[model samples]
Target: MTLDERAARRRYATVSALFWLPLGLSIAPLVLLLTERGMAMTAVAGFFAAHSLTTAALELPTGGLSDVIGRRNVLAAAGLLNLAALTLLGLGTTPVLLGLGMALMGAARALSSGPAEAWYVDTVHAHAGPDAELRTGLARGATATDAALAVGTLTGGALPWLIGLAPELGARLGEATSGLVLPLSVPLLLGAAVEIAFVSYALSALPEPPRPPTPLRHVLRDVPATVAGGLRLGGRDALVRRVLVSAGAAGSALATAELLTPGRAADLTGAPESGAVLFAALACAGFACAAVGAHLAPLTARRTGGGERAIAASLTTSAAGLLLLGVTTALPGAFALALAAVGYGLVYLGLGATGPNENDLLHRRVSSTGRATALSVQSLALQLTAALTGLIVTVLPPGPLPWSLAGAALLAGALLWARGGSESRPYAIPDATGGPDATAERRPGHGRPLGGRTGARE
Candidate 1:
């Protein structure tokens, strides 16, 4: 790799780490915090659904916005939005206010989704040429993201308990604030501070590539065309369509794990506060496992004979983990908690492994101009399916059933890429003559080769 390419990779990994850390800090305790504020489980589900719905509604638009405006600008905007949203989440007591906060958070998530990665891809391709290797850098960024989450989850989980230990401090702070301040809110407020850092860093660290100048009117006119073109790719390209479906299945698996795991942790611990700590530890462990899986992706792909096959195997492993979680719901004591933790960790590991492999394929199918939009489309599918899955799981009685259903869905998704043959090889776009083409073929002889040149046109 060139020096410029190495610098770009470092920047990408830094952005990935920064982007995920605050979110990890907030995620482990969010449900418990809301419930502590007097929300019932159903109400909590509604809040989650609201967040998902908002993200889904805005995903495509924000993706196009990134393509229209500069990626750095859109990322900065997302960080600013997250600052407001986290503040509201930390301070608000009423459901309406909190719901608004959740909606804003979703908007932030949508805006942030593809810009950083898009910037990295665009930058690397510009510096290193289209056929430059991408998987190694991409995988490194993924590992960095998971590592941030692991650290943040561990610290966030412990913050509330640490705060509670200082009775005199807590009492004085409580009195000064008229009891609005609480131990549980500290981590979220800290997360808000992190957003400030994120916004500043994004503006300073990410450079925008030169493109055709887009005025407000031009953006308004052209963004829809870009979005439509991106949407059309899913139907026009068989590989992109399958990738979308796989994203949806992955979303379902994620929704099931996030929704049910905290409750299970609480049940094991017999208290919400303790549950937060336990869940945080579990989340940290899961993210650690995810990092390992992401780091091992290249090797896994080579061993499995292709990226598609690796994805299939990873998804199947995730399904089995979910199945284990479902089946062990009735087990007693520490054993069950241990089993659940393993299951949870495995799911994250599988997801970590699956993501880069799938994205590498998707990147091969689209041009740079539409890359962010294509990623948004994939995210839209995931969020939409997750929102639906959340609703369905909410009404079902807690047990093995919801998890089993999720596992089944993941298994079905795996089957989409399970077939062995030339299809498992790195995908090549058809040539103008409509014959087999090798212009953008993956590096020869490896099913899941890392760092091959990207074929997407600008």
Candidate 2:
């Protein structure tokens, strides 16, 4: 790799880590904090639902805004908003205030979704052309992200426990903040501080190619068209559609695991407190597994012949994991817990492996202009499917049924790539100006095995 390519990879990985770290820090304590702040379980669920709805509503528009305005700008805005949201969540007492904070967090999530990855892809492409070894960098970024999450989860979960050990410190903290800053709120406050750092680093470090000066009116005009074009891309391009469907499948599987795991852990441990600890540990393990899988994604692709087959294989592995979870639901004692843990790890591993390969194919099929929007479309599909799957899981009777449903969805997604053909050309959707949208021009030997490490065995 050239010096520029290496630098770009480093920057991308760093930005990814920074962006996700705060989220990880808050993950373990968020629900507990909300409960401590006097929200009933139903209200907590409602707040989360609001968050999901807000994120889903804004995904396309925020993605289009990034594509139209610029990645760094949108990312900086996201960071700032997240900082505010974290502050509110950490200190706010009332449901209204907390709900607003959750909604803002969802907005931040939507705004931040695609810009970082889009920036990396665009940067590396500029530095080393379209056929540059992207899987390595993408995998590194994913690895860094999950690694940050694992670290944050452990640290976040520990902070409250440590504070609890010193009851005087906890009480003093609560008194100083007028009962707003409890021990449980420390992680979120720390996360808010991280957001400040994230914003500063993003603005200073990541650089983007200059886009043509666009007026407010033009931005207003273009975003919708861009979003519409992005929506249409999936319909016209079979490969893109497969990616979207696969995202949905992955989402369903994730929703199933997340919804069921806590209760299962509680049942196994016979106490909610112990189960919470077990779940936190399992969450950390899952993130670590995901990091490992991401680090090995390039090798997985090489062994599997191409990105398509690798995705298929990875999703199949995840499906198997889900089915294993279902089968083990009836098992007794420590052995069942061990198998369940393995199954959980497998699910994340396959998901982590799937991301780089699927996105490699996606970047190959779309131009830089619509790249962020396309990513947002993929994210939207995932979020919507997860929401729907969550609802279904809620209605289904407890047992293995929910797990089976998720496995079936993922298996169907895996089958989408079971049959393969030569890689397709970038679809020529019309730009806002009514001409064919500019695409990354394909060179001779376009779509070789990822990283050019082997022959075109696909």
Candidate 3:
């Protein structure tokens, strides 16, 4: 059965929207409350720092798990973990419990990140064939995350007032987002419920595609080789490396904002609650801008002839935005916030456009049965980059550090722009021609006789 590209892609998009809505809802208020409850200035640094550590630890292993078991299982497990984390977070307010909660969230995020795209690709590839649509859909799926974030943020912000009005109407569920009794916790519980619902949706709505019954043990053992190969592949393909590196740098810069913004806002606002206002504005603005920017993806791709160069441009623009944001004392902070909001907006769109190209690069090089393994390897790189970005932001001074991160990220973009297609132009897999024996025509996972589907499992 050929994969119906649009149908499967829509499912993947739904997956992103459903999975991320709860994530944003839970995250926004929880971070605010956690800071108020126990995040001393010192502990504040550790929050994003710990995210990096937890992210790195879980990333590759979960990716590998998807290859062996299935992406569906990985996503389901992530949702279940989110539910548990939010539950623990709501029930406990102590430092240790909060740390556990944060760690759980990080792990779930890392696990859910890459495997979903790989699964969607496999499904799409199985049914129809590879083309630009798969790439576009993959990226749009990610951008849809910003939309979900916006909707969830607005909903969370409004939920408390809507619930409190029940007093006049004589209703009972209680105010969820109101500062009255920690509306922060309410979002988490609600978000977890949404994710569980999404899990059920996935189970009932999406049918699993056939896959090789590769032994779990052999797949586990091959993870190291797979990772090494993926990195090497990045090195070998300039465009893929450019896209990955540029995206990573841009990602790091954004993570830096996420790392420092709350603390910065607290200093400026003199009220912890005010930070949530700024945070929501930045998040919602970024989301709105990103959605609009995603529509320009095809244009960016057309200009660059690939996503890597476009991603580079995004990083450079982000650097400029961060630099502008750094001197908020002079710009009066609001303007700086506006820049960052718009900056992140474009950043998400740029990455979204380029995401498919990089993934397609890998899929083109590998056979069908080996796509998951190869994808896991790439996921590891992306996650590790994000982890590093978070860690760097945690350690650096909150004010100018974002500027520095953005600048460094711009350097990555510059390098990619300079490198161009000299290397990438070669081995450039043409878009797959729809035909029988898709496997017969495609490249092997590792380009080794031993890298065949059966050999990979062993």
Candidate 4:
């Protein structure tokens, strides 16, 4: 790689780690925290749905906003929103306040989703050309993200426990904060601090390539068109369509795991506090597994001779993990807990492996102009499906059924790529302007069939 390419990769990885760490810190204890604050399971599910719904509503617009206004600005806005959201989450006692916090978080999630990765791709493409080997760099970034999550989750999980160990400190903190401070709130407050750091780092470190200054009217007009164009890609391009479907399935699978796993931990441990600890350990392990899988993505793609096969294999692995979790839900004692942990880790691993390969394929399909928008479209599918899944799982009896349904969805998604031939082959995508015959200008490797390493089109 060239010096510029290497630098871009490093920056990408660094930004990825920073962006995800705060989220990692809050994931394990969020449900537990909500429950402690008097939310029923259905209420928690509703909050989750609200978050996902908000994200879905904003995904395309923010994606277009980033593409037009620049990634740095959009990312900075996301960090700021997160700071406010986390603060509200840490301090707010009422359901209304909590719901508002969740909404802000959702907006933050939407704004943050595609910009950084888009910036990385655009930077590397500018320096190294269109067909640059994206998987290796993308894998490294994915690994860094999961690594941050692993470390942050373990620390976040343990923070509450450590606080409890110091009763006087805990009491003083509660008293100082007027009874708002608690073990669960500590990680979120820390996450807010991290967001401050994130904003500072982003402003100072993230450089943007110059774009023609867009007028407010132009931005308003162009963003909607860009969003429309992005949505069209799913309908117009065969591979893009399949990728969107796969993203949806993956979302459902993730929703199932996220909704069920913490409760499962609580069941095994028999208390919310103990469950938080167990969930933290499990989340840490899962993130570690995800990191391993991300680091192994390029190797897996190479071994399988193409990205498509690797994606299918990863999806199948994820489905099997869900199946395992479902089947073992009824097991007795320690064995069930152990199996659940393994299953959880496996699902994360599969997702980790799948992400880079899938995005690598996606990156080849669209130009830098529409890259972030395309990614947002993918995220939209994921979040929408996840929101629906969250609602569905809430209504279903808590057992293997929800998990089995998720596994089945994942299995169907796996088959989409596994069927091979027409489905796995990329097709030319229309440009963001919706110009006719745009496909005629398809990049050399853009819509190639995946097969041998020579056709890997890295």
lDDT scores in order: 0.81, 0.87, 0.60, 0.83
* Runs with alpha carbons beyond 4 Å of true place in candidate 1: 1-3, 35-45, 175-180, 266-277, 420-458
Give the per-residue lDDT of model 4 (tens digit) for 145-201: 999999888877778879889999999998898889788899998999999888887
Error of 4 at 279 (Å): 2.8
The sequence of per-residue lDDT tens digits that candidate 1 reaches over residues 31-51 is: 778988898999888897788
Deviating ranges (above 4 Å) for candidate 4: 1-3, 31-47, 94-96, 266-276, 397-399, 419-429, 435-437, 440-458
For model 4 the TM-score comes to: 0.89
Residue 368 of candidate 4: its Cα lDDT? 66
Cα-based TM-score, every candidate: 0.88, 0.95, 0.77, 0.89
| Superposed Cα deviation of residue 409, candidate 2 (Å) | 1.2
lDDT by residue (tens digit), candidate 2, 94-132: 999999999999999999989999999888888777677
Task: For model 2, name the residue pairs that clash.
Answer: none
lDDT of 1: 0.81
Candidate 3 lands at a TM-score of: 0.77
| Candidate with the greatest lDDT versus the true structure | 2
Per-residue lDDT over 92-139 for candidate 3, one digit per residue giving the tens place of the 0 to 100 score: 667777777778877887778666677777776667554323445655
Whose TM-score is greatest here? Answer: 2
Better of 1 and 3 by lDDT: 1
Query: Clashing pairs in model 4?
Result: none
lDDT of 1 at 179: 75
Error of 1 at 131 (Å): 1.5
